[model samples]
Target chain A: GESVGLHLPTLSVQEGDNSIINCAYSNSASDYFIWYKQESGKGPQFIIDIRSNMDKRQGQRVTVLLNKTVKHLSLQIAATQPGDSAVYFCAERIDTGFQKLVFGTGTRLLVSP
Target chain B: NAGVTQTPKFRILKIGQSMTLQCTQDMNHNYMYWYRQDPGMGLKLIYYSVGAGITDKGEVPNGYNVSRSTTEDFPLRLELAAPSQTSVYFCASSPRGRFQPQHFGDGTRLSIL
Candidate 1:
């Protein structure tokens, strides 16, 4: 079964530090990827996204790096804040049409002030 | 903008009961999706709609059903509910594109007893 998965289930970091979350995917046909943040008792919020054509994309304080060679993805958050504490998931789009995403298990980011 | 809204924030159902989870998006996005999240796990797609009158099953759609009558609404129905169906359900919408980010609703917490 082709699937996307996280390298770590949980990551703890101190405020003001940088945090990186990794994901590995098995589907080579996937062309698009996204990162989502889910807080306690809430739905997932879109953070950043990257296409297979590009190696990286940056948001406000977040960056998504894609390595098509190894089928790996990573999300980097600079100056990690307490609000960044949540479960982060990496999702991949299997096709070029309508964009149905396959989500990974998730990595819980714990930021302590 | 009330991007995406889901009704019945919480629900408790007995075995064999049936109910529909309402999802509406004011963003007028053409792509809608339904996903379920279990405790300590990431979200799994249940169903998705590319546009009005077009629907498709996702990763986990065996025990769920969905319909897309219009671009603004996509509801999920659960018939003969089982305990395994208990999870937090989220509705999301996104523009038509290859890598568009999805806007999600708060979620409906369902408990099957």
Candidate 2:
């Protein structure tokens, strides 16, 4: 079965440092990707997104990089803050008409002050 | 803006019980989705709606049913609930196509014993 998996289950970083999370997808048809942040006992909040046509998209302090050649995606957070400590998930949309989005297992990010 | 709202923040049900999880969005988004998240597991798509009257199954739709009577509402019903169905359920909406980032509700935590 095709699946999207993260390279790490947990990440620990110091506050004010940069953070990077990676995801690999087996589905080649995935044309759109997104990054979300989920705090404890809360729903996922959208971070940033990128289309297959582009290699990178930047948000306020977040940047999403897509490497379609290897079906890899990464999210970079500048000046990681304590509030950024949460689980991050990468999701992809394989079929445009279906409006379907599938998520990865997630990576727990812990930022220590 | 209360982009998305879910009712019954937490619920506990006995085996064989039935209930519906309510989801509403203020953005009047045309795309709505239902997803379930188990402990230490990735989010799984339960069902989705492209528009007010169009609905479809997702990755994990066997034990759930959804109805989208209006663009603002999409409810998920669970009949004869089992322990396996116990998980945190989230409802999300997006303004654009499948490629758009989703706005999610706080989520409903369901426990079936």
Candidate 3:
């Protein structure tokens, strides 16, 4: 069955260190990808997004790299902070549904101080 | 703006009970979605609406129903709630398709015992 998944279910990193989270998507037709962070007791928050036209996109302290050839996506967080502890998710737009978004299994990032 | 807002931040339902999850967006976005997050799993699309009076099934539509009466409101209905239905529910909205980012509300934690 077609699905999107994360390479790691959980990741632990020390504060001030950089963290890298990986994701794999199944649908090749998916052209748009996004990264989201979900804190405990809250909903997923938008982090960064990369369109197929670009292989990489950078944000404040985060970066999203897209490898369409392998259907792989990655999110890199720099200078990780204790506040960054949360489950991170990657999503794709399967098709145009007026900005509809599809999600992947999440990876919990534990920023240990 | 309030962005997206979900009602009943937390709810405990007995088996066979039913309830409605309310979602509203003040962004005037035309696209709204309902998603559920399970333990160790990613957010699964329960339903989505393209606009007022238009709704469609998503990746996981079983045991759930949704209706979009206006651009700002999209509600999800759970009938005969089961243990399997226990999860965190989220509501999100985007301006429209075309690679726009999404804004999410604080999720609703639902547990069926």
TM-score of each: 0.93, 0.94, 0.91
Task: Record all residue pairs in model 3 with backbone atoms less than 3 Å apart, i.e. clashing.
Answer: A98-B96, A98-B97, A99-B97
Please give, for residues A1-113, the per-residue lDDT of candidate 2 as tens digits.
Answer: 13334343789999999999998876888888889999999999999989999999999999999998999999999999999999998988878566677788888999999
- Pitting candidate 1 against candidate 3, the one with the higher TM-score is 1
lDDT of 3 at B57: 86
What TM-scores result for chain A when each predicted structure is judged separately against the true chain A?
A: 0.91, 0.91, 0.89
Residues B36-98, model 2: lDDT tens digits: 988877888899898998999888998899998899999999988999999999999988654
lDDT of each: 0.89, 0.89, 0.87
CAPRI grade of model 2: medium
For model 1, report the TM-score of its A chain: 0.91
TM-score of 2: 0.94
Cα miss at A110, model 3 (Å)? 1.6
lDDT tens digits, residues A1-113, model 3?
12334354789999999999998887888878889898888888889988989999999999899998999999999999999999888888777544556677788899888
On TM-score, the leading prediction is: 2
lDDT of 3 at A87: 84
